[model samples]
Each structure stands twice: as structure tokens, then as C-alpha cells.
Target: MVVTDVSRPDAGSPGTMPVRRKRSRIPGWLRGVIWAVIAIAVISTASYSTGAAALTSSNTASTALRLALPILLCALGGLWAERAGVVNIGLEGMMILGTWGAAWGSYNGGVWAGLVAALAFGALGGLLHAVATVTFNVNHIVSGVAINLLGLGVTKYLANLIFAPVSGNPRQSPVVPKFDTYSASFLSDWLGGLEKEQRVGISDVAGILRGLVTEVAPLTMIAIILIPLSYYILWRTRFGLRLRSCGENPVAAESLGVNVYLHKYVAVVISGAFAGMGGASLVLLRGGADYLENQTNGRGYIGLAAMIFGNWRPGGLLGGAALFGYADGLQLAGGGEAVLALLYGAVILVGVIVVVQLFRRQWIAAGLGVVGAGVLYAIYWSNDTLPSDLIPYTAHFVTLIVLAVASQRLRPPQADGQPYRRGED
Candidate 1:
């Protein structure tokens, strides 16, 4: 019948080459969802087994959100500056300035005024950074360190002058107004009932959702909205393109008339403003808006870690902040028992990694994963609770581990931390 076989390209046609079908890769959002699901399952199982209800409780989730807010803001600040080719090592300093400004503003005016003052103070810190690194071409790291010192000294002195009289403490300020929180009308109640059921994964998810919808502060809502807003501005807008180009290649951007210097300046200034807002979050929420000495307590550096873990993206940083905040919140909620439950969770997570590594024929990695899982399980079995002193460092430990794991996948701005000057090719 001489029927032509159309299925095989190379079968009938002369000099035809067979085409290979490309493998479909999972979308980033889908991958994130899968990982989140896996994490939830692991934590939920651990929570049930250990009877550590705090692991999945609404209180813990709420605490995590509260703790994560400042870090998220600071990370966002770092993202803005780095994306525009400026390395903002002075985020801590900007945040410090923000705390003072927030306390002062809140005491004199109100919570809203405090927020505005925080942004202004942070912008001031950013301006100093820009003047040093952008105008004078100072070393980014050096300038950042100097700015940190300056922020600390200036704030301390100001606190003594302004706050000490009323509070009777140089490192403290008078009580300021705090933002009120809101809960979704019916959703919070519905979710709370579902969470009370304690039905494994479903209950765990409900608790998390309940926490999100219940008693959420206005500032928290603002911080959450910034994530998507940042994505749209940086990825979709022309100004964002120019800013990112400056970070990637300032000379190239300048060649294209992108005004690299101006973009860098604006980016750094914005970065400071964000950090300042982070500081404001801490002050306004902590103990009814009272400013305490060293309230930031290295959150600035932690936020920078979150930024790195996120690989310099808004969504990624949010996850990183959430992770650190969760660790911190768990310790605060359930004390040592909660931290112990986390060990069990780690064991399960490591076991999953081992299985994945085995499937990929990664013999060494799988072997290491097995050992890690075994050690973690052993620790979990032996200890009923983690040491009290160690609880405070749980977030830091999480930060180091997460950074180590994610470091290989990170790709920072090409010209990050590099000094740039006009007319210099």
C-alpha cells in the first residue's frame, strides 16, 4: 500500500535528523509550593508526635509574623540597594536610626507620624551611605561600617538627651502609641474552630491561616503587600530596569544613558527607608511602643542574611524571613520543647533529602544526608528540651544552616559591593 509513516521524521525523509523532545521543568512557584507542602507535612507530623502543640499553634504563627516583619523590611531595603548596584552594609545603622525616630515621633504625634519619621530617618542614613559610596567612591563595606557606628553613637546620644529625662534611662524612651490590629470578620472564627479540631495537616494549615487573618496589624499588612509590589516595580517598570542595570553593569547602563549615579543614589536611599521602617515595626509593636536600648539586637544583620538566602528577590526574602521568624517564635512559644520538636522536623527533612539524593544517584550527598538524619534523630531522642541559653540562638543557627544550604544556588548582582564612579569605564 506504500503508506507513509509520518511519526518518525527520519524514517522516510532523506537527510532528516531526529528531534529530541525537551524535558519540562517545574515552574518556580510550583516548586516553592511543593517545598512548602513538604515542610508543613514534616512539621505537622512532628507536632502531633511530640505533643508540642506550639509547633502548629496560631499563637506561634502570630509571633512568627510579628518577629519576621522587621527582618522582612530590612531585607527589602537590602534588595532595593543591591538591585541598583549599591551594597548597603549599613542597614543596621539605618534601622537604629529608624527606632529612635519612630519612638520620638510616636511620643510626640502618634503611630502614623512615627512611621513617617522612621522613613525619614532611614532615608537620612541612606543619604550618608550614598554620599560616601556613590559621590566619593568610598569602599562600600567601610562606609557601611562607619555608618553603623555613626547611627549607634548618634542614636545613643539623642536618647540620652531626649529620652533619658522622661524615662530615666539613656537607652530607653517614653511609651509611644502602637498600631491597632484587625481580624477578618468570620474567617478568623471559622479558621480558629478548624484549628481546634487538631486534625493533622488540615488543622495545622488552619492554625496558620487563622494566625494570618486574626489580629493582624496595619503595618504587617503593609509589609506583606510590599513583596508583590516590589516584584512588579523591579521586574515590570522602566525605572526598575535602569536601576537593575546599574547593579549589573553600571558602565553599560551609563553608556545607554541610564544615569547610573542617580539610580544608585535613589536605590540606596530607598534601602535606608525600608530598614528604618523595619526598626519602626519593632518599636511600635514591642511592649506598647516603648523604645529600649539595642532593641534591634542584630536583626539588621539577620535581615541581610535573609536577603542572601532569598537570592535577592522579594518572594525569596519573604520566605527566608518567615523561616527565621518561625524558628525564633517557636522558641518563644514552647520554649525548649518546641526547639526539640524542630529537631525531629529536621530529621524528617533530612530523610527526604536523602531519598531525593538517592534518586538522583548522588551517592556522597545521600550518604551525608543519612548521617545528618541519624545524628538529628539521636539528638531528638536523647533530649526532652534544648538548653535554655541556646534557645535565644535558634534563629541564628537556622540562619547559618539555611545560608549554607542555599549558598550554592545564589546568584548576586554582578557588580555588588563594587565601587563605581562616573567617567570610569
Candidate 2:
């Protein structure tokens, strides 16, 4: 029997390996870029044709970047873990701990101190995960679940003990210091025009660019910088190759004198560090708000989706993050139709009602569809817009559509969740 390198899709299958598609000639990152360009072109054309506002504007671009940063960092963390052949479901746990650490640090020292605490706490969580998965050879998923549970309990308990007495509650912390956001006046004027709030011009490009360059968090700048840095480190460094090899085939790497255990530990720990910083960045963006329980929400899971969508490459991750972030920002941007924001919200609201009623049972669902249609008719009777707060649910649906369509191209590491030992056959 042949012992194949497990990272490749065709590794153990030999003759059964699949052929590539015609479009496979285009790399995944390039494909994503092309699709993005096409999407912008199509949306722009439709907007111009209908005499509507531009699909993209300075406001939406800025908000999307802020939304994308945490998810991008978490996705990068996932990339590191999976590439090293470890399935790290513990990113959520690490992020939770990071939030607590950040709150404590900020409350005592300052925002920068909170950042340090977040990284340290996150690394500690990674260490625990690595010990369970790598050292003891436990199931990766099980280990991750356990870490999440522990993180939840420990953070809450610590928050009560440390912050509750002071803030008078176990669920929240005292406010932390904040970092200043910066703006560029020239970029705002040149790239984002002053008066085309009602029209689409070639100048919309400048608006989007201005949003990207100004009124931004310092951490957002750092996160953007980290994207290129991650790509270079993972693809170009000698240590990275060894780390990837450990994921693909640890036995082969060991045979070639690589330190498989060390690499796995390093990858997991680094992943945790990134996750922790992601939590800190999130809170810092709020600018001195008390850290509350469950603040990370489900962004960690979204990061995993982004990792899959990116085809597990750094550049692809960037594209994936941007797409998801833009989707998230759509509600705020009224789906890029400032005039129709309310109308869109009413339609979406009724659609959600129909879906939920249907999921509860069949007859009730059918009834809801009829009632929903009537409600929809009533809403468009005046074609009036709805409140911005009512439109906040748009991103979840946008995420679903994007994931359903884009996940078709994903290919995960072959032996990602497999167990291995130094002398395994």
C-alpha cells in the first residue's frame, strides 16, 4: 500500500483523482477579484439606468471596512490552524477570553494595555487547546468545545469577581480608553464628491476610496497591513512550509527531520493571538464602552465561512472578508438605495415572517405566505421607506446567499481532522 501525502485532494485516491475544470486555469483569488469587478459593474449599470444612487458610497465603504476587520483576523486565525492540520473550533473561546482580558487591562492600565492583555489571554487559550489536541492526541473538535465551555465559564466568573463589584454586575465591565479615528479632508473631497449624494458619477470611485482612507480606526489600518504580512509569512517563509507540511503529513515531515509537535503548537498559539486581538479591536472600535457578555457573538463562525470562501489563501481571505463586510454594511447603506431603504426593509420583514411561520409547521407557513403577500401589497401601496433599525437584519441573509453560491469552489486540507503520531503507518 502507498502512504500518500494527505494534504492533496487526490492523495490516497491515486487513479480516482478528479480533473480540473476549464475555469480552473484562473486562480481562486483572481476569480474572486474578477467576480467582484463584475458585480460592481453590474450594480453600477443598474443604478445608472434607474437613475438611482450609486451601489457604493463613501459611508458604506468605511462601515464595511470596520465590520470586516475582526472577521478577517478570525479567518486568518482559522487559516493558520487548518493549514497546520489542526481543526481549531476554539477560536470563539479564545476571542471570549480576549474580551475579558481587554476589559480588565483597559479598566486598569489603558486601551493599549488591553490589547496586550487580549493577546496574552488568547495565547493562553491556544496553549490549552494545543496541549489537548497535539500533546494528548485528543479529538480536535471535542477539545475546541471544551475550551469554549471553559472560556465561557471562566470569563463570566472572573468578570463577576473582578468587574462586577466595581460596576455592580457580573455581566459587564467598566469602560476602557479609546483610540482616535483619523480622517483625510482632501481624500474626502476629491474621491468622495460633496453634491452627488443624488447622482452617480465617475467620482463615486473617489468616494469609495475616500471612505477606505479616512475616518478609520488605527487597528483597522493594522489589520489591513496584517493581511499582506500573513500572506508573505505563510507562503514565503521556510518555517511556514514546515508548518504546512505538518498539517498535510506529519509522518513525512518527521521523517524529513521536521519538528511536527513544535510546529503544531506554534500555529495554534499564533492563531489564538490573532483571535484575542480581534476581540480587542472590536471593543476599541466602540471607543470606551464596557465589555459585555457574549459580545463576540457568532463572528467566529462567520470567520470560518470566510476561510472556506477564500479557498484557504490569504488573498482569497481578503476578498472573502470584503464581500462579507459589504454585505453586512448593506443594511446601513439601505442596500445601496438610500431612497428605497424603508421599502426594502418592509419587504424583507414580511419575507422573514413567512419563513419563520413556515418553519414552525406547514399549514401555518402557507397561511403566512398569503397574509405576507397582502402585507407586502399594503407596504408598497405608498412605496414609503422604513426605519434604518428595521433593516439591520439584512446582512445575515446576504451572508447566506453569498455562502450558498461561493462555497461550491471550496477545497479543505485532506487530512485536516485526522489523528497522527510520529511513527504512524
Model 1: CA > 4 A from native: 1-14, 18-22, 286-289, 354-371, 406-408
lDDT of each: 0.86, 0.73
Candidate of highest lDDT: 1
Q: Candidate 1, residues 1-425: lDDT per residue as tens digits?
A: 24444466445576555455567998766766787888789889989988988888998999889999999999999999999878899999999999999999999999999999999999999999999999998999999999999999999999999999998989899878898888996999999999998887899999988887888888999999998898899989999999999999999999899888899999999999999999999988743347877888898988998998889988788888988888888888889888888878877877776777677777776776677667667878988777899887854564454444333357999999888878888
Against the true structure, what is each candidate's TM-score?
A: 0.93, 0.79
**Residue pairs in candidate 1 whose N, alpha carbon or C atoms collide under 3 angstroms:** none
lDDT of 2 by residue, 42-133 (tens): 44554455444534566777777877877898888889988999998988889888889988998889878988999999889999999999
Superposed by TM-score, candidate 1 places the C-alpha of residue 207 at a distance from the truth, in angstroms, of 0.8
